[model samples]
Target: MISGSIVAIVTPMHADGSIDWEALSRLIDWHVEQGSDGIVAVGTTGESATLAMDEHKMFIKACVDQAAGRMTVIAGTGANSTSEAIELTEVAREVNADACLLVTPYYNKPTQEGLYQHFMAIADAVDIPQVLYNVPGRTACDMQNATTVRLAEHPNIVAIKDATGDVARGRELIEAVGDKLAVLSGDDATAMELMLAGGKGDISVTANVAPAAMKAMCDAAIAGDRAAAEAANAPLLMLHERLFVEANPIPVKWALAEMGMMENGIRLPMTPLSEGAQPQVREALRHAGLLK
Candidate 1:
């Protein structure tokens, strides 16, 4: 299972926006040391849009190599195009990634049937494990319960990263197909609730800055310890809401830099956290005890 606090890691870049492999390796080591059970490189949080295909593949391969079996590495190999998605997934399998997180197609909104065929094509195309990423907020295309259940029948499509933040929908999906597939939360704000309601884990952005606390929350909730889970949840309560004050990786990347974990550099169109937005995010970090 791709369960627990899996950081949707940031792509550490130089001040000039170049990939910093040394920093990248250090970040990986830090996550594993902080007790992150998995690393999701080149996902949305990693600024995947700005990275070229080769760069994406290189990043994934490097993370897999660095992890070296210490933790699961789930490559973000999603594309709006079926053929492109298949190619990315194939490259992920070649790198020996444990699984691939395939997000819904963006820009080109597809019907439910199209969604099914798209994932079906990729699942059939690749022999490796596949986890469907249904982040309707990002893709503007939601994969309903039926579409997911249809794909769930495919053995290779093992799980889901549900970023919808709709607890009811998550519960329904779990009730309908929890036995067939693991439903992982992609949204941090509702991770604990989703877990209590039957989510397997979180594909978390907050985990990048506070892995231990986040992991503790997931572990407690999954173990049926509500009070302990809520106690662990206190520090994360702010992070659950503030990391998205602007756009993801903006506040998060800046938070990591504040903690001296990584450079705050971000690619074009997605700049660093706004000067105005810093104080609140910093306070959230302070509340979480990640910063002062």
Candidate 2:
């Protein structure tokens, strides 16, 4: 039941690549006002890869405290390491996050059985609702449908964020285990279609800039009102496609900054949005009516 437009929110930063705690608070408040069903703090879009361990822990705690039950705060605790993932999930649990999202082990390319053990290990270690994340494109690790269905048996494992963008396969996964767990779409461009096909909702990067529209689309889609969902999603189609014109968050963080929501302060290794891609991103926002 943890459904609807869950934003994989970016961690707002100062121009010097430092966390902008004040901006973070403001953004969370905006989502609450805009009707986002939930948020995944420190997720991939939040630049989790570069955060110090203490920063990561504090980031999740801050989001949870700020949200204050106005909306679901799902801590993004996934790591390439199982123990690290467990430790992060434990932190989420201690801080009272609604759920923790754990991506499949990356870089090591663990086998299917290895993937199973890795997730099962974490579910065993943490007594909290857990959501699986499978973005093979980013992780070079794909959790097959069978493995996901197998993991669904664990009472604590409640959902999976399917970023594969394959609606056909997503439908298969839903039919296989939709009764046991929610299959949330992790890819925004195809999220509405997947939801119409039975996805519970989306973990959206696009929602960072257009929460109300995304929430409206999700509300319609989840309610089986395809016409309404399509109308709500039409304006955001460009946002969904353009947000990734560069790498993630790069375009999205820039979009947010353009809207005067936050500073355009991306971390090193991930620089500010390039001058070339800026125009299209701007047009995307304009098309969505998020900007004039």
Candidate 3:
């Protein structure tokens, strides 16, 4: 029952785009101090796509070691190839991560049956608790509520991160699988609504910059305090929308750098936040009280 704001933390990098271990340790410590319930290391926001296998393993292990049991560490152990995903999950387990966040297979776009089998195989291979990540916008594969319910039966498949941004559908999924699996929102914009509708928490991008605010909103929402949640979330609406003004991690990484939390370095294929978009992100950060 790992609930509340679980930050999909960006992997801090140097200007040359190499992993910045010192910055990463600082970021991890900051999250623990800021009251972040958990951290998702090397996930989509962490540039898992750009990181090499060795780098991915190293980052996850580093996150687990740095956190040192102060908070939950959910390693991103997903790949389009089932065997590759299994291998990553094995590494997460090896390093004693609290759980593994496995996104649906991308590009190849497997059938629902294939998706079910793919997730089940990994769950079977690794005894560690696994959280399903379904972000069709990025993965090109949508794990429907039915298919997700099917996977929820697996003991190791403990939860799902629904990024569809459909609150109605999210509610339906909550009603159907809420008893069996922990339904978490991966979409920041609609996270409050989903949480009020019985979601456990959010695997949040917004938490990257405003972890304490996100955690307060989640805590309030999970407690069924809509008024309290809304009060906490009102300031974050702009951030939820603007952080995606460019592709993820680009804007979020930039926002972090702006707050002096990290360097303004993003990898190839994911450039730095464009000059034109910089003001928009900065405004959102200011609105959230992250910047002066």
Candidate 4:
């Protein structure tokens, strides 16, 4: 059970578009001290698509080295191609990541059988624990419940980061595969509702900014303390909504840069926070008490 708050951490960068390994190590230390139970490196929140292959492998290795056993490091090693995913999973194993998060194939809408086969091949390729990530909104190929249940039968496919944000469906998933696998929320906006409905924890975007609050909220909810859970999350509602005003790392990178945690640089095809959204992102940081 990968319970409690797990940050889908961002990949910090230098102004020249180089990986900022020093800041990244410091961020890892900060998250551990803030009570984040685990870290997911190079995930959607980490701006995976923008990272080159060499940088990706090095980032995962850096995270594993910096955490040094204080936190579980989940490497986001999924790819649109089956063999590519296997390649990355091999890297994950090489670095001794606690587990690997395999997102549903992106930009290629494979059939249910295709999804099953894709995951099956990766599972066969690696011996590490695996968590499936289903975010159709970004990947564009949603993993329906039936496909997910089928994949859950695999011994290596141990958990899921459900980001569909549909509570009824999430509850249905729990009812279908609850006892067999862990169900962690991936959507920060609906994290509370989904978790109360049986999710073990969250692979949270909000955790990047408010790690202690997110961890406390998860711990309280997992303990069935609804009041404490709600209280812990109240101050973060605005951040949950605003950090996403732009697509992902854009706003998150801005927030982190504003806090002096990372450089404001990002790879091509994704730019810095849109001018209009900068003030909102800044305020979200201030509202979350991350700003000076």
The lDDT values for all models are: 0.92, 0.95, 0.95, 0.91
**lDDT tens per residue, model 4, 122-191:** 9988999999999999989999999989989988898999999898999999899977888999988888
Candidate 2 has a TM-score of 0.99
Model 3 segments more than 4 A misplaced: none
Per-residue lDDT tens digits for candidate 2, residues 1-292, read: 7899999999999999999999999999999999999999999999999999999999999999999999999999999888899999999999999999998888999999999999999999999999999999999999999999999999999999999999999999999996899999999989998999999999999999999999999999988899999999999999999999999989999999999999999898999889999999999999999999
RMSD of every prediction: 0.8, 0.6, 0.6, 1.0
TM-score of each: 0.99, 0.99, 0.99, 0.98
lDDT of 4 at 186: 94
Q: Tell me the lDDT of model 1 at 76.
A: 93
Clashing pairs in 4: none
Off by over 4 Å in 2: none
lDDT of 2 at 124: 96
RMSD of candidate 3 to the true fold? 0.6
Instruction: List runs of model 1 lying over 4 Å from the truth.
Output: none
